[model samples]
Target: MNLAFIQNMGGGGIVTILLFSLAYFILWVYCLVDALRSNFKDPNMKLIWVIILLFAHGLGPITYLILGKNSKTTN
Candidate 1:
């Protein structure tokens, strides 16, 4: 197949990439929502975590799930 045809059809790589993006988006949204709903020990930290999740893209949610959880639980 031609390059143009493959591009137009969204070949295997494209499909995989799209699926990965969708998964990442879902995970990010889940993290954002969780961060919003959760209570933090510091009181002010909930807003900070939400901002981090908003800007950090790949790492923000993961960080919240990890270190942020500990901080919040300590309260």
Candidate 2:
């Protein structure tokens, strides 16, 4: 393998990694915001969800969005 080939491959790999990082960062931030704004009646629940989302990354956010409470109406 020539130095030129290696350099080109490295550059492409870096770009791909950077793009994935950016997307993940944006998703994390969005999930954090959504968890904070969620209506769970308890502040502790919100904090827990936010921390879970941050640590669990993609799966956590989706779980929170799907299972979290809806504060639109009271029973």
Candidate 3:
């Protein structure tokens, strides 16, 4: 484990980046699980959301949180 990179990041930079990265990962996983568990109007939507989350990285989960969440149908 090379911590030299962290030291070079300068004054809490690595910490800030790590926090944001962790937050993003959690959000992405939550969105991914919700997409898998929830029912959507279109049966194919779950697959689409999953694909987007896996490939689109940052923007994918954010978009799904904003838009895809509302698109789920109540059972």
Candidate 4:
């Protein structure tokens, strides 16, 4: 994004946006790692979810966290 535009948005808005972005990034990474380490019933399911995470930036991780996490096979 343009740093100039962000600078013009005032302090509180900037802080809130930065914090939300950071939190989102953390959640995305956590979901990616969790998907990688966990076993799924179908081998292709892992690949599918990974692809989803890679492409579907906004909703992919949230959907995985809410729905896909439960679909993993327990050791």
Candidate 5:
């Protein structure tokens, strides 16, 4: 609420922020690797999706997870 109250929390806020940032970075990296590893019938489509995911950051990754091609084999 107040600046003094925030200051009283000392390094706790900084630690929390650092932890969240690290987690985000890890998730971003995981998404990148997953994008690379995915198998799509169209290589260009796969590349486009990877580019979207890499450039759009959080939103792109969520979209890829929700709407990108699935790699399951079809009979």
Candidate 6:
């Protein structure tokens, strides 16, 4: 609830934060790269995904991964 409480938790909070940040970073990078390489039916979709990944933080990449893919591909 307070700074002292967080401090008393020692490395747990710091480790958790670091781990979450790392995971988010990895996910973001993966999504960005995938979006860049993806073949969208509409070329504008690539730009849209890039913009979303840039400004939407954790949710943007997720949205792209979930909904931005070209469904025509089997891979």
What are the models' TM-scores?
Answer: 0.79, 0.62, 0.84, 0.87, 0.67, 0.80
- Between candidates 5 and 6, the one scoring higher on TM-score is 6
How high a TM-score does candidate 4 get? 0.87
- Specify the highest-TM-score model's number: 4
lDDT of 1 by residue, 1-75 (tens): 556756676578788889999998998999888888887878888889888999899799778778886866633
What order do candidates take by TM-score, descending? 4, 3, 6, 1, 5, 2
Write down the TM-score for model 6: 0.80
For residues 5-70, could you state the per-residue lDDT of candidate 3 as single tens digits? 877789689779989899888998999999999999998999999999999996999899899977
Candidate 5 per-residue C-alpha lDDT over 14-41 given as tens digits, one digit per residue, 9 for 90 to 100: 7897898898888777777877877776
> Which segments of model 4 are wrong by more than 4 Å?
1-8
Worst ten-residue run, lDDT, model 2?
66-75
Better model by lDDT: candidate 1 vs candidate 5: 1
Give the Cα RMSD of candidate 4: 1.9
- Ten-residue segment with the worst summed lDDT in candidate 4? 1-10
Q: Which ten residues in a row have the lowest lDDT in candidate 6?
A: 66-75
List the global CA lDDT of all models. 0.82, 0.72, 0.90, 0.91, 0.74, 0.82
Per-candidate clashes, comma-separated: 0, 0, 0, 0, 0, 0
Q: Which residue pairs clash in candidate 1? A: none
List candidate 6 stretches off by more than 4 Å: 1-6, 70-75
**Model 6 C-alpha lDDT per residue in residues 1-75, reported as the tens digit of each score:** 457777776898889989999999999999999888877777687888889999999599788778877532444
Q: After superposition, how far is residue 5 of candidate 6 from its true place, in Å?
A: 7.1
Candidate number achieving the greatest lDDT relative to the actual structure:
4
Q: How big is the positional error of residue 10 in model 1, measured in Å on the Cα after superposition?
A: 5.6
- By lDDT, highest first, what's the ranking? 4, 3, 1, 6, 5, 2
How would you encode candidate 4's per-residue C-alpha lDDT over 1-75 as one tens digit per residue? 657987689999988999999999999999999899989998998999999999999899989988897788888
- Candidate 1 segments whose C-alpha is farther than 4 A from its true place: 1-10
